[model samples]
Target: MAFALQGRDQSLVALGCRKRYIRGPRRADALVGASGPAGSGRPHQSGTQQQRQQKQPLLAEQLWFDEERILVDESFEAAEGAQLSPHLKVAKHVGSGTSADVYKLQGDGKQPELVLKMAKPVPGLRRAFQREWMLGRRLNAVAAAASELNMIIHTGPAVVSEDKKGQLVFRGTVLEGINGKSLDSRLEKDASFCDVDFIMMMLQQVLTALHKAEALVGFQHGDLRISNIMEHSTDPEALQALRDDAQTWQAQGFVSAESAALAKGLLTFKILDFGHSKINERQARSYLKLSSPNMNTPADSAPAGSSSGSSSSSSSSSSLALQRLPAAKGPLEAFYSFWYRGRSDSWRLLRSLATRLDGR
Candidate 1:
């Protein structure tokens, strides 16, 4: 797998991460004011009640993964006074995915090439759009904190709105255009990344970007395909810092020993098209509430088919229908199973970069 861009998803067989997705909104990345205990599950510290103080704030967004945004919807938005971008004018349909369709909207020249990603009224429809929208913000937040990555644009919130093709069938999200094709396409079209210097530049840019996302939001781009990476930009100040003080970034643990070098020119990349991403393990465990999954109890972590109770099927609420996963052992782990999982986005990044080293 090459470090390509466009965020087009790939199957993560090792992590059991699926490539397909349905479209919808997500409340995952939203910050609930950083207060007392929140989301599902208890904290990592061993505590009954006294120690569980105000460490974890309740983030309703995490529930969207287990319950598929059922806790919040358009009505929820309305009650909360969340602004909605309804009746968007789409120029044309560019592509289609397993659960959603991609379109390009006519920009007013000042900011042209905006994408209008839409999903059908299916089960995972809202989740698909919400994942890209929220995860994109998390990525952007990382870039913002780093003076170097601030120059690039990942994406904004998914202003998803329900439309009526007949009976309210169409739903869509607006995203800032990623700009450019896949890495393979870029390579075949032009050999910009054939040099070791360019490879090293790409390595640093991508490594730092991944590190920021994981560190801040506990996000895991499980479907780390080459196409998921794109040619992004970085501030000259930051790129220069990487070159002059490679040791600094190394000490911070953003880059591996093998990729301590830097390229002469600026090269930045961002992970896009998060159609197959999930929250990380440690972060996910923070949501271990009574209703959420329990790692100690295998039945609580069991899938819909294996679980003795048809809790998902037997539920009367339609929200239960949209809820994808039944149990979450930790916080985001409710979205993950109790089995062996992978958390090596950095290792995988290096492994994918190794493709360029074939026959060397």
Candidate 2:
């Protein structure tokens, strides 16, 4: 038998539905007698409407601008009257990646020169852009830490907005366009930096930066190759003081004259590119995978049509499978390939610089 259920007050018809007043089949007779289908039933109430309202998702704000007509877009234009000028002329493209291109930009009129990084939306590179944004945000949070540690240079404001195509674009965090050769470039032109002491000092400063980053943010630079380092000349008195110290150390037989001079000449080293850096735990695992080549090969590398012999063998002989992984070629290559391959050119350049400095 089909049962018809309805509410008590309003005349809301509910076909094949149970009545609110009825407890079970035993009470159905009483409920039917009290509230007949004619016009005595109450309204039908379901929580579906309220549930839908609560389940709605939030969306990010969308920004748009005109690229052709405006020298600077609306978002930037809004900041025009402010003391800090946002308008900058694209001088030249310094670098380009899968999702973004960095341009050395010169500010209009008297504004400070800036580095403008224009990001394009690519499905594959979206994650990289998002990761960079997250890193930038983290760096901003720990800006004070860097300052306290006297780490290279702290990053500035990183503004994220949309372009003419409505693609995500990021600006700000302007790296001061310093007028000097990069550390690698200087090492190539001059062998004077090859002194052991100089190299040690440079490495120490770099390590200090890494330590600061770890202490403040719990992450060391995954890619700390040379080309990312830039050099600035030191004060004459400071250089002379280092030279004097080197001579004193040389007299004591503590360090060689060449090493002392090189160390004295050491100026500054800046670490860049946090794109590949991972937290402590992830970094350890990544290092292991990178150092062992066998861990990178696919278990199904056996001929496509062949029986899964290798797979079965790999499963059976775990120790042998682990041994199959090759040793890392070199420390630099291992780190770059495992974590920063696409940006290997910078690292290679740095390596070349290090070699040249050693020869000097």
Candidate 3:
């Protein structure tokens, strides 16, 4: 599908543009006291107790592809009155995945509730967190003005720390906490309150945001499963009030005021987990080349009508279509081609969801 950013959304796109580089806070910066272990760092149960705990089913977020754990520096902020400093108070560990450890955070009175995602300190995993930080910084730059377009969680200022050897390390990232649950959580339980229209609207909102991201900076969110999609719990009454306030402002010819009012909590669906995202033209080209179907397979040179060739022909045709997309094509052509490639896992996920919804 050829998705273009709407003209009206141009300003919205610029609203989250991070044009400048953001430096992490150094040791000279105020330090939030090191976050202590959850409730006095008690030891775990032994033998059957531990085995029984392991036997229990994992939460949606905890179900990572692997369980190799790595210890990392968790003290990223300074201490303040009975709470962690830097405007974030660590609440508790929420979940863990191969990429990052997720934690719920209680923001100081001046800040909103947030989540902290600390990447494992393993060498191979460093680039993943760096990519996520880069993308988040880009999105966060515009969040102050384009609150509605702040679909992806807003990350607070980067907190830096040093290892024992004196090398600087990215302790973790603090992100805006959503008032609602992930789509997986909702889908696994009673979602009767959200009608089909609402669900579809949420889907549309997410796709629109993705399209905007592609148009502005050629970002492909590599992970788009149900767990990565968050539906905001913004109340209907609050939304309605915002609409009313916007209308009132509009009537007074205060166009900017109206937009500001409407932008408040206008976001419904947010696409998360850009840890695997491919950013910009170079990365996109590399991804396409890596993922293109039948790049040099035997079927590419096989004679017509054979079963192998016949089956591969369909896949190859799609690949050919992507190749044939003109180099001088419009801004969205690259995004379209990338999404249509056979290895586009997120596209497959969308298709699966559509099939399931259609069946229901």
Candidate 4:
């Protein structure tokens, strides 16, 4: 596929025949400056009122602007010693996002390197946890039946633990092992290492996973970038087999056949993270502007397809929905074929590989 730079022109089509767009109203606080009764500053007051006023502290302990204090309580370190369940031990901190903090956990002895993705105590993140947990379960079910989908990371069963008062606390989902280094890390280490053949293999596997996911789950991977792609170290024999296949494809004129260290078949790629994924619900709109990370603004939203612009509102006050273009079929298609606006991780990979190839 050719990599081209183009401006995005998407439609904001609702999923089903009757589209329902979720929009958040922009909160505009009006600061009105008022003087006591329009210049009647010194008004007489009752003795009881004056006495009560005098008793009140001039500087209230609680400030209205304490909203910004949300940052102080948003530390990922707070979950350092936290535990998911009696069996699941939340260990070292792995990563943090706006809605959740990822921790390396030790599950059953058989699965020592498990990951626990615990959502922060934010109401807005409820959907994120739900989406991920549901999607993970669906993928796992599919993988269990189909061996082709083995590439998709299978998340463990989701658990909803309670706090001290027996109230349902934040939601959490356990993922398989740490998987492998992200595609970004590998490229950062050696961008030049990705030749045409290697790119083809990676893309082939990723696209394969995407097609399966879409067909089986009826949803799209909202965020498909280098970082979201994981590269697993493979065996030497597998690497040789991949190299042989590439050579065959090259001879068939299907690929340019440029030679580069393929990391052997040693590098198998797996798609990671479903935080931005959207289900194919007929009642849902094609385009969504979530207030969570990777979904802050329309510019950062994932591609679904094209549709007519419309507007709707979300039940949560934090969410803001706008009338943008219709969603495309995931970011992968958008990346290779500039059918929409915004950055595509797949497109970036293609461009980077092209640049590296030209340099050589």
Candidate 5:
């Protein structure tokens, strides 16, 4: 059988020998048809017409398929209250940065909270976002097999789709809402943590997770800072004790030795954000160039050079300087350099506290 369709301004012909139909103008909805025997009845009376009439509109209203490929326009954003699928409800934006915007979304109640990261489809930046999704998918698969690390949030498989304007977008696993406070916020309220042994333990856990990522997976978390770590306190009494000690230390210049020790023992930690992560053989030199204004620098790394007053002038100068810096040989070297710097300080604190406690 053969079929053909001619619309107001375009024509579509499906040849049985070729088994495909030609697609037309951007404004034209695809007139999908199939060809059979030579003497086929009026094309309008064919089953394809009936099927097209019976087909429901796409769930994602702005999405469509043309010539067997998904076509999405980059200019259109998802409408307010737009539904991606029957179960997924896209809500207002939760967070946004120059690189991407994260939308707070809801899936079936059976699933966890969803955070959809829509990477602003810049030509070169899409690969990094795609890499993150690949790594997240790999980690999700591994997480299903091993339950040792609770610090890494479970990331569902990554899905690639287009927004209303046909811009490619990426969505990954639904993240469970964490109840704990960010390490940055906690530290702001209690700087005494800098001196506490519990903080050292929490740091150890974070390091352990990074080590796993390095040794087992051969991936480097390109960004690591206090804001990305979450603290979950299981014991209200323990949390209160740490808070009390912080207050006491701030007021009296010191806390009771026992309370101080107990406060240090009760620290809990979780790590978040893997957007800048790099895989074993991947070249991640571009990551350093795409720095965020709010991103924290390492405690020990040299301070960034001051800008030359003009924003454009400063950016050019900074880019030139960054270009001059030597790149790490591989992901392993980058992982060690970044993780070890933080690990050394944590180990030093642990050793010092151990000595003070008479080798406890």
Candidate 6:
């Protein structure tokens, strides 16, 4: 099945029909702004009144403007270290999902080309939009661990202004676009293409990625299907040679980790579409560790088709609700507990692979 871009238009927002949708109110009632500088001392004033006019040393005087000015006129400056910015010129239609549209960015001298994901104008989809943005930020936050990641680098959101009121709106994000086709695309062309060797190599890569992904972000690869797995475009000749000699590679194998570098790169895939991926609200980094003793994959666990998210919320104000996961403490330990507990990202990946193979 195709992820958002390919053919799956279904959205996570649409799935949870009971969830609340924050309506877009016409105006923000109040903004917590800084107070004005202290008046030179009113000796006769009451203690309470004195507090209201308290002098500001480091801060400037209160510069209150109409509420409209705060939101409608000003664009949100990117958070201190964020890669957020206004949308670049769109080159063409890349794809559309239930909540957003993806586009190829126009070339510019200042930045490498990126893919822009713009949220649909519908207000109901805001949370889903925010969820994806947050997920990207989470992944990028730990990108130094890139040696272990397979997901694309999420640059951040696109900003736009409404034509009617000129209000600055956070439209969506910019992504590091890759030259590629989905695993599904690759499979659809040749069902028998994924021989044992190819699939096994891909599986190894997937497991490593999921392990790190769970540690840094989460376990539920909400949509772990063929469409979300990108097979980077490779030299046709090189690819044909590998495909032609799959059995040979399978039998002989690589002499070293460095051997068959080209084949590895071609078979290795990058994952995308975080719109449905969920994470811990309290501390994402600490919760999905692979070190927990209870996280091992069960030898007799139910097959991939069983439902995953079965755990309930642990505390008030926030709920984790991980998939069949035992309470995990850190990425190293957490992912292990996730594995031993009979459900994890690896399970989902294998399940998806199994389904794809069956279809093929």
RMSD of each: 15.6, 31.6, 22.3, 25.5, 27.1, 23.7
Question: Would you list the C-alpha lDDT of every candidate in the order shown?
Answer: 0.40, 0.38, 0.43, 0.44, 0.41, 0.43
Superpose all Cα atoms of candidate 5 onto the true structure and report the RMSD in Å to 1 decimal. 27.1
What residue runs in model 2 are displaced by over 4 Å at the alpha carbon?
A: 1-87, 92-100, 108-113, 120-122, 146-153, 163-173, 189-193, 233-266, 279-360
- Alpha carbon lDDT at 40, candidate 6: 15
Rank list by lDDT:
4, 3, 6, 5, 1, 2
Q: Which consecutive 10 residues in model 4 have the weakest lDDT in total? A: 26-35
Better structure of 3 and 6 per lDDT: 3
Q: Report how far off residue 309 is in candidate 5 (Å).
A: 51
Error of 6 at 348 (Å): 2.4
- Give lDDT: candidate 2, residue 46: 31
lDDT measured at residue 301 in model 2 versus the true structure, 0 to 100: 36
Top lDDT model: 4
TM-score winner between 2 and 5, please give it. 5
Clashes of each: 33, 10, 8, 21, 14, 24
For each candidate, give its TM-score against the true structure: 0.46, 0.43, 0.50, 0.50, 0.46, 0.51
lDDT string for model 5 (151-173, tens) is 56544433344444433344333
Per-residue lDDT tens digits for candidate 6, residues 69-92, read 111123433232233323245667
Could you say which candidate leads in TM-score? 6
* lDDT by residue (tens digit), candidate 1, 1-360: 234432323333222112222222221111111112322122122232222223221122221233221111333222112323332345666777776667666643534346655565577556545545544444443433332233234453343222222111114555555444455455455433334334535555565455444554566665565556765322345544665875664564433222332221233354566655655433333333322332233323422222223123123122211123322233333343332154355655545545434333
Candidate 6: stretches off by over 4 Å? 1-87, 150-153, 160-168, 217-219, 233-267, 282-343
Candidate 4 structure lDDT: 0.44
